[model samples]
Target: MRKVNEENERIKRRYLKYLKAAKRKDPSTVQKAADGILKFETSTNYASFKKFHIEQVIKFRDRLNEEISKTTGKPLSKSTIATILAANKGFIFWLADQAGYKQRVRHTDADYFNMDAKGQRVASAVRESPYPSLEMARHAFNYMPEVSEIDQRNKALFAFFMLTGARDGAVASLRLKHINLIDGCVYQDAREVKTKNSKTITTFFLPVDDEYLTCFIEWVTNLRTEKLFGPDDPLFPPAEINVIDGAFKVVGLKREIYKNANAIRQAIKEAFTRADLPAFTPHAFRKTLVKWADTHYPTRQAFKAFSQNIGHSSVITSVSAYCPISIEEQGELIKKKKKRNEDD
Candidate 1:
């Protein structure tokens, strides 16, 4: 069987470039769009984009419906299906406008790639995701052992996350200079840190338990005084591994930054597991912080500041995306409002 069509590959490259340069999509989003197009090409046996048809879309949808997820070993989810279809649909629509393919592909035929109304609803449903509460986060931080350098670093990392709801990518790339201990703020300079959308963010240390701030301060002091680390040194450096007893083992801290957030995530997972709590991703901390903000900063100006602290441009983005009220909490709020109305 033919592995790939040269014409299709050329068109795909152009489409990906358009997504990045014109649509201003991030790398991950562009990669997803690339994957979606690849999957559609595979389904069509590497057919050229000019050969795109409504029947081909219908057949591809059927194939995706019967496909299984490699990670979960289950059937493909409706959301996953919808995402893949949407990518292909967008590509087909664009192809219809292109010079060479304009006569071959119909603009309206791209609409056939869409899932039914019921399927769309299922794909777009807002389901609650599990995140550690503030208490649970504090418990996890307190439980993290600080016996060794690695242990101390891990504990500090957790405390830092609690103190400022910065994303994992930003945390992984932070330098000592970026954090102002006196000001109690983290300057996520996009030029130096791997921030989301390359956005520069100034995050003030959130009002949380004092213990978390104390832990982080001590860790930074140790790095500066004991380890002789400079301002440019990583806030949380990677572990130095050496062969011990004919086996590779982590011995001490390395004076280098992490290549990515994978190590940071593992450390967080281990810490939570050690604390007998569910391992939550660093992003979950944002949700916890947003929820905390909702209760403490009820006023619009205060809430907006809190949102901006977490790198959100708008308060609505923070509330709609992160601080979803639980069903139980929603009911209690409504009941409280009813009592207030009756009193008035």
Candidate 2:
């Protein structure tokens, strides 16, 4: 019947602080660890961590496996389960080394939280995710209507993603000063823009269709001259909603930045829907750029430059994370190599 434990709460607070301060984990990552600990606590009915047992872990694993996701209305996925277990395992292992509870909890007890080999493999398996090709993106962009200001902004937003391969968060927080239209690059100043890991990235426009660059140029030009927006104003302003005929409608730009990337994502979805294409997330454009770079920039130096432009510190991270080879492409590459061998 107990809902909370004071002892557990004190320990959890210290643990979360350690994760943030010592481990240098981000706020979201720390929150996940907290959620994992809470799950274990709930399974044990708010029992003290000092009374931790391997049986508790077993029961928690079983419960998680049988758990259904409220959002998906389906059983929890292997990856999700694994992630939860890993978080708990990490916390328990750290707890074993902490003062006062060192005698009660053993480091080996944490091993019980791990999934079996097969489960781990299934959870970690790499699969190809959907992203638009350069040609497909161009086709979609061409179909985007540019009659109204909202339509123009939406169209330009899609093109901006393709042209710069900047992340949605950075795009949402960008100001007019961040973009260099003359140099065909975006200066993602972490102080102003919400860049990932607060990295200050300078991304040059990729050499795609001229239409993408042209569209973005017109939008920025209009923002500066026609709208009379200053450098401090939002590059892609949030929609200004007004009541017309007792109905709320997006009347025009608000001249303010989006608090998050949600609005940017909606704009992207609308653009793709209008173009009769799959509504890909703004991040998908990074994968598209990586895929294009794999074929276009064959040399190591050229590829490294391309990777750096997209905010990756190393080429390996860019290739391994984004540039997944399809089965069809893999087979064709092998066959081509065999043909070259035979010719020799």
Candidate 3:
């Protein structure tokens, strides 16, 4: 049995390169597309693309419906299924135009990659996720124990995320000089920071002043004065793991930065779980910020700047993606309309 498809692999590499260079897609997005294609190929027993049939897509979709999520050990969510389906659909759509595949595969067959209408609705429906309120998140930070230097760094990471609404990747790549305490802004220089789409933007400190923001500033100050860390050093430096008594142990801290967002996410998950709160991924903090802005901002321009603070190019992009009318909020609006009708 074949473990790999050479022809498919060659085309996949080209497709991924196209996605990255031409489409300007992030690594995560490209990775998902690659994973989806790999999964489909494996499911088809590494069948040659030249021998493809529409029936294979139908079979794959049915199999996907019955698949369980690796993380939760339950059936995958509609959103997850939808994303995978879309990836598969896109690959086939693109594949249909390829040299050998043009005759074997039909472009219209890719339509079979879509979920049913009801399934599509379920996949697209917005659901309320638990995000810690500003006050609660502040309390969580205050409550965080910082006996160790590594602990201080971890706490500061959470505080920085809340204060700046920075994406985790950018946070991991931030340097001390990127921050200007006097100006109260972070300069996400694309040359140094892992900004989305390699965008360079300046994000001002949010109005969330208190112990949380104070703690972050103090940590940076301590790094500069006490630890003598330079302007180029990481804001929340990586943990220094040492071998203690022939066993690995987390000791103090290092000047190194995380290679990626995984450590940041793990720390956030652990922090929330320890706080007895539902897990809110780092990205969820952006939603929390948007929700906070919606109730606080008086004018559209103010709200638009709030969105720009998080690195969005436009206000509509922010509102459409992050600040949807939540289910509970929709209910409240409906109740108000009912009362107005009764008054009339």
Which candidate gets the maximum lDDT versus the true structure? Answer: 1
How close to the true structure is residue 74 of candidate 3, measured as C-alpha lDDT? 96
lDDT of each: 0.91, 0.90, 0.86
lDDT, candidate 2, 102-192, per-residue tens? 9999999999998999989999998899999888788888888888898899899998998889989889999999989888899999888
Model 3 CA lDDT for position 180: 91
Tens digit of per-residue lDDT, candidate 3, span 107-160: 997898889999999999866667788876766666677988878888988988
Model 1: per-residue Cα lDDT over 91-173, one tens digit each: 98899988899899988988999899999999999889999998899888878888889999989999999899999988999
Question: What would the TM-scores of all predictions be?
Answer: 0.92, 0.91, 0.91
- Candidate 2 local distance difference test against the native: 0.90
Q: Which residue pairs in model 2 clash with each other?
A: none
RMSD to native, candidate 1: 2.2
- Regions more than 4 Å wrong, model 2: 1-3, 97-100, 342-344
RMSD of 3: 2.3
What number of backbone clashes does candidate 1 have, counting pairs of residues 3 or more apart or in separate chains? 0
Q: Candidate 2 — number of clashing residue pairs?
A: 0
Off by over 4 Å in 1: 337-344
